[model samples]
Every structure is written in structure tokens, then in C-alpha cells.
Target chain A: MIKATNLTKQYDNGFVAVDSLNLQVNKGDIYGFLGPNGAGKTTTIRMLNGLIEPSDGSVTIEEKEVKSENALVSKLIGVLPESHGYYNWMTGREYLKLFAELYGVDKKRIKSRVEEVLEWVGMAGKADILIGQYSRGMRQRIGIAKTIVHEPSIIFLDEPTLGLDPQGQKDIQSIITRLNQEQNVTVFITSHLLKEISEICNRVAIVKQGKLLEEGYLDELIKGYRLVLRNENPTLEDIFFSLTTDEVGGSI
Target chain B: MSSLIKKEIREHVFSRKGVWIFFAISILFSGLTYSFISVKELSLLAQVEVNMTFMKALIGISILVSIILGSTMVSGEREQGTLESLLLTPLSKVKIILSKVVGILVFWLIISVISIPYFYALTYGTNMLLTILSYLYLIGLPLVISFSLLSLAFSTWISSSKNATLLSIVLFLVTAIPMFLSTTMKKSGFAHLVDLLSPVSASMLTLKDWLVNRLGFFFIFMDSLPVLCFLAISIICLFYASKKMDFLGGE
Candidate 1:
């Protein structure tokens, strides 16, 4: 479980990347955070995960402060940043093992845990190959594997399926769903893919220009939107466009 | 901590950069050794002089390599997008920085080992071998580490590896200027102060006392105080700079 209260990030150049916003992600829920480009989605995730400090307000994971140096927070959550970079020189197995050790996995269990994660991400067959040689889809899988190598209770994925093909997206979606449903792990994923979010996330939040526009259960939100639009069956795309668009049919 | 250090060594020492530097240093030492053995005018000099010359080259090359390693340690990870993951780990920032320092130290150790045969060959049939080894570890080790830490501080403050490396090298050259100055110029007000303050000059002066003048260890240690001070200052600066280190780098 994670809670952010009056969270805000103001840059030195007078740009407020995330306004004073509140969010709660319940345990074992696949929570999707939605926003267009420059909508503070990534910034919010970074704040919650303790990668960057929020200018004002605080984030607590399971009632522990999400400070940068908090070991408990580090153990509580895993994160796959939007622009996650790999060590091209390292093999997939080596990369995972390195993270496992860093995350304080039992020394004896490191090798087995790495192999298990590689298998979980469907990278077991290619474990020995250098990450640099992997295809983009393969790299994405390995990145996700790294995120969960320590088996953290909560995982934050920032645009995990951004550049993937349809099959690649499906593979990642299945992994996310399996982690939530089977393993009972909480997921806080940020993406602009409405269909992908709708397919996997039970709860969703939409934001624009650093402010949250809506947050609720997906079905309830959709039903509410359908009634407001006077349509019996409206796609999430329609609802998203209606909510995120200005009166002049321009993105706000 | 050990895992991070091992990763650094693998990424750097076993990489092409490490291999090429080792190969080039081997060739340079071979050439220098051959010149001392075969060259007409060079053969006339004392064996200790040739050995000291080798030691000087070794120290210079080691410092350069350490600078390169230190300057790239943080920025390279940041540029490659790997710093974020490392920072997200439970490892303290100080431990992360210290792990990088350990990596540079390992390289220095390897290069020092590589120079052994050359030092042995040059100091053959002389009583200077043990003394040379002692100074190499005592004087040279601290100097190399000082520069490495100083350069690492720069790397933390500058996001671009190129700029950090350039600034570190320039700073090193400025410190080494006293070593290149003429006796007359060194005695001048500004140069004299620099020569007294410069760690490189202090190191060279201590080496000269040990090898050429046969000065007592106490006297040599007194002359090497500046090098020790520089090492202390570099350590302080590095820890201070590391506090500002972040996923994006810079304060």
C-alpha cells in the first residue's frame, strides 16, 4: 500500500511538474496512472519511489517514509523507470544477479533467484547472451525482470510497454496481471495506453498538466462517463478524449 | 558493496579500455627499458637513475589512468542510464562512491604489478629495489588515490564525462607544472610557493631524497607532507561532492 499527500514538485525554473496532489494505491491492486506527455505522470512515480525528492509533501509506503536512503522503503517497492538503461556489456543473467546482490537477497539464493526471475520474464533461454544484443522487446522483458528480482511487494512501472509491439505489449500485460493476481503483488503502472490500462488495471487515475482529473474504479468511471455522454456503450478512448480535451477540442 | 566493486572492475578493467591501457603501458615500459639497456648515452647514466625514470613514467601513467577512471565512474553510469538503478539500491551513497574508489585502486594495483618486472630488471644487482617498491606503494599509491578521488568529485559535479575528464586533467597538469619548472624559475616567488604546495612536486622531491640523495626515511616523510595533505583534502572533497550525487548528477 502507498499513500501520497499533497505531493508537489517545483523545478528551479518555476515549473511545477506535479501539483499538490493526493493518491492512494491499495495493496494487491493493479493501479494504472494515466496522463499525456508532460502530464507529471513520470514525476509523480519518481517521487513515490524515492528516486527524486518532492518539493513539498510526503510519500509513505506501508506507513514508512519513502526517503531516498530508507532501506525499508527500498525493500518495499521496485521500480522500472521510463528511460531505464541497461548495462550493454552485461549478460542478462549477470545483470539480474548484480541487482539481486544489491537488493540484499540472501547470498546463497542469489543465483537461483536470478534464474527464477529470468524465467519469469521469459528470458531463461537467452540468459547468457549480452543485453546489448537483445532485441528491444527482449530488453524490456529483462528490465522488468530486474525490477522484480528481489520480489518486492510493490512494483512501479513507468511506461513499460511504451515502445513495444502488440505481442510484446501482451507479454508485459500478462506478466503484470500474473504478478497481481497470482503473486498478489501491488502494481502502480503509468501509461498513456488506454486499452492496455483498461485490460489489466482494476483501478485507474487520469491526470493532465500536473493535476489529477479523475480517479476511481475503471468500470464505475466508464459507467459514469457513459451516462454523462448519453451513450449506452462508450469506449475508454472516448471517455479519455472527452475528459482530457478542452472545450475547443484541444488537449488541455 | 563487494558486488558493486566487482561490477565496476568487470565493466572497466576487463573492458577494451583496460586491456588497451595495459597493452600500451607494457609497450612503453619495454621501450624505456630497452633504451636504458641499449642506447649509448642512456647506458652511461647510473642504474638508479634509469630505474627512477621508469618509476616517474609509471607514476605519471598511473595518475592519468586513475583520473580517467574516476572522471568516468559516476558520469558514465549516469550517461548510460545505470545510475538510477544503483541509487535506488539500499546501498548508501558513500558506499557507492567508495566502491568506485576501490575499482580505481584495483586498476592501480594491476598496473603496479605489471611494472614489477621492469622495476626488477632496471634495478638488477642494486640495493634500490626494495626502496623503490616501498616508495611506489607509499608515495605513488597515495598520489594516485588522491587524484582519483579528486577526479571522482569532479565527475559527481559535472554531468558530462568529457568535461569532467578535461577539468580533472587540467587540474592535474596545473599541479604538475611545478615539476617542469627550471631551478631558477622554481626559486621565484610564485613558482616556489607552487612547488612547495604541489603534491606532485612533493612526491618527486621525496623520491629524489630516497633514491638520489639517500636521505633518511624521517627526512623523506617530512618532505612528503604535502602529498599526505593533498590526499586528506581530496578525500574530504570527494565525500562532500558525493552528497550531491544523484540519478541525474550535479547538485
Candidate 2:
């Protein structure tokens, strides 16, 4: 389980990227972090992964301080950032192997695991090609493979399908679904794609301008706001549009 | 740490630019040695001048290559967005920096080893130990120092690899200007000061003199101390950089 308590980040210029944010994610849960661009989704994820120090507050992963640079924490969590720029010189196989070794997997297991992940991401045939030659979609696939090579209990995927084609997006969606349901991994995903999030996320937290506007199980949130007019029935999309528009107009 | 180091090495060795840089250094060093040997019956002044020029060129190349390699150390990741991915992994910043340093050092060692044969063939019979020592002192040590420090410092200060690359180039040129001016105006106080501040000039002066005549141990130690200090400073800068890496996206 991941729990963030009063988490805040204040930059030197006095801009609060994250403000007194409180969040909790339980095991086997797919929690979608939804926000527009520059809405602190990335900042919050960075703090969760122990990449950036929070100005105030603390995050605990499995009851251990997230700030502590422990090997166990690294082993337990897999993170795929929105943009993963890798060494262009290395082949996909080599990249996966490198991380496998870092995660302390046995040498004997490294090759098979790498192959398994490459195939899982549907990039097995391109495993030997240098990353520089791969397309953006291919890179994203490799990024996912690298993140899951160690089989971490918790996976954080930031914009995992950012540059993928529709087919590529579907492939990643299935992989994410399997990872969550079958592997029982707690998945924390951040994206601007509301439709995708609505489909896969068990619960979601909508953040705007460094604050959490709403968070709850998807079905519950939708049900709470569901309305039946005597002569008109509004679709979920219409409700979504109205809520966001109302929020923008200074009413939540 | 070991795993990261291995990854660094693999990246460096396979990199297109890294391989080309090594090739160029080898060819340049070999050409300089050939020219030095081909000139027969040279006056003492001429020999010293030629040796000095060769040493300066080696130091300059070392600095250039080091900066090129080190400049992209972290900024490249930021630019490519790979840094976030790496940081998200469970590795510490210290491990990342150390691994990169080790990788660059390995490259330095490989280039240094390759140049040894050329030096051996150039100064085949005349004071072989001295020739090898001079190369190490004058060329190898300064290259390591300048590259390590400037690269680490630039990586820390610059937000993008392109900026770091441009700044490093400018800094290297500026640092080398004093030595270039000193060579033209030989015996001026300005020359001496420049020589003192410039690692290339200092190394050439100390190593060349030591090669020709026996120096006391105390003098040798004193002369070599500055280079050691530069190296120590480089390591410290690397540590500082690791601690200061923001990880979060910065404006």
C-alpha cells in the first residue's frame, strides 16, 4: 500500500507544485491520477518514487518512509515516466538486462526475463536493434518492459501511452490490465486520457492546479453525480463536461 | 553500483562518438610521435619546443574528449527524459554519478594504454622510463583532472545537454588560450602565471624538466601536488552534484 500524508512541494520561487495533498492506494488497485498538463501529476509521482524531495510532509510505501533510499523500496516499485530517454547505443535486450542486474535478479534469470518482457510488450523481434532506431511507440514499449522486468509489487506508469498509435495503446492497456488483475500489482497511472482511465482505473483522483479536486471509486463518483431529467438523460461524457466546466467556473 | 558501472561502460564503449574520439586520439598521438622522431639532429631548444607542443596537444585533446563525454552525463538524460526513468528505479544518485565517473575513467585508461605503444616507439632507447613518466604526468594526469572537474561542474549547473556542450567548449577554449599565448611570448611574467594556472603548461614544464635531469623526491612531489589537488576537487564536485540533483523537473 502507498500512503501520502499532507504531501507538499514548494519551489524556490514560491510556487507550490503540490499542496497539502493526501492520497492512499491499496494493493491490487489501479488508481488513475487525472489532470491536465502542468497540474502536479508528474510532481506527485516524482515524490512517490522518491525522485524529488517534498517541501513538507511524508510518503510511506508499505509502511516504510519513501524518502529512505532503500533497495527494498526500489525492488517493490516499478516506475515508467512519461518520457523515458534511454542510451541510444544500447539494444532493447541489453537495456532490459542492465535493469535486471540492478534489481539484483540472478544472471541465469536475466536472459529469459528479458526475452519474456520483450515478447510481453510485443517487441521481441526488435530486441537486438539499437534504441536509436526504434520509433516512439517502440521506445514506450521497451520502457514498459524495463519497468516490469523486476516484477515489482507496485507499478507507477506516467503517460504510458503518450506517443503510441491506437493499436499500441490497446496493447499497453491489455498489459496493464493483466499486470493488475493477474499479478496483483498496485498500479498508479497518470494520464490526460479520460476515456482510457474510465475504462481501466478502479478509482481515480482528479487534480487541478496543485490540489485534489475529487477522488473516489469510478463507479461511485459517476453514480453520485448521475442525474435523470424528466425529459432528458445526460450521458457520462456530458456529466464529465459539466463537472469540469463547473469546476473551471469556480464551483465544484 | 557495480551494475550501474557496467551499464555505463557498455554505453561508452558502444557509443559512436566514443569510438570515433578514441580513434582520432590514437591517430593524432601517433602522428605527433612520428614527426618528433623523423626530425634528426635537432637542437636542444628545438627538441624541447617540439615535445612541449606534442604534450600540449595531448592535454588539449584529453580535456576536449573528457568534456564531451562528461558534459552529457546527466543533462542528456534530462533532455531525452531518460533521467526520470532511471531515477524512478531504486538506484541512489550517488550510484549514478560514481558509475558515470568509472565509465569515463575506463575510457581514459583505454586511450592512455593505446598511446603508450606510440610513445614507446618514439622515444625507444633514450630514457624509456622517463618518456613513459612524462606522458603520464604531462598528458594523462591533466586530461583526467580537467575532464573530470569541468564535466561534473557543467553537468550540475546546466539544465540541458546542448547548453552544457556549448558552455564546456567555450570554457575549454578560454582555459587553453593562456597556454597558447604563453607559447608565443615565452619569458614574460604573464607566461609564467598562465603556465602556472594552466594544467597543460604546468605538466609540460615539470615533466619535461624531470625527464632531462634527476629531481629530488621532494621537488617531484611538490610539482605533482597540484594535479592531485585538481583530481580531488573533481571527485568532490561529483559528490556535490549527486547530492544536488533535483530529480523533479526544474524551470
lDDT of 1: 0.92
lDDT of 2 by residue, B26-53 (tens): 8888777766766564323344455556
Tell me the interface RMSD of every candidate, in Å. Answer: 0.7, 1.9
lDDT of 1 by residue, B1-251 (tens): 99999998988898898999899999998999999999999999999889878898999999998998999999998998899889888888899999999999999999999999999999999888899999999999999999999999999989999999999999899999997899999999999999989999999999999999999979998999999999999999999988889878763
Candidate 1 chain B has its poorest 10 consecutive residues by lDDT at B242-251
Q: State which candidate has the highest lDDT.
A: 1
- List candidate 2 stretches off by more than 4 Å: A227-239, A246-252, B39-52, B134-139, B170-178, B181-197, B247-251
Lowest lDDT block of 10, candidate 2 chain B: B41-50
The DockQ assigned to candidate 1 is 0.79
Ten residues in a row with the worst lDDT in model 2 chain A?
A228-237
Candidate 1 clash pair list: none
- Which candidate leads the pack in DockQ? 1
Model 2, A103-210: lDDT tens per residue? 877789998999988988889999999999999888888988998999888999999988788888888888899888878989999976777888899998887778
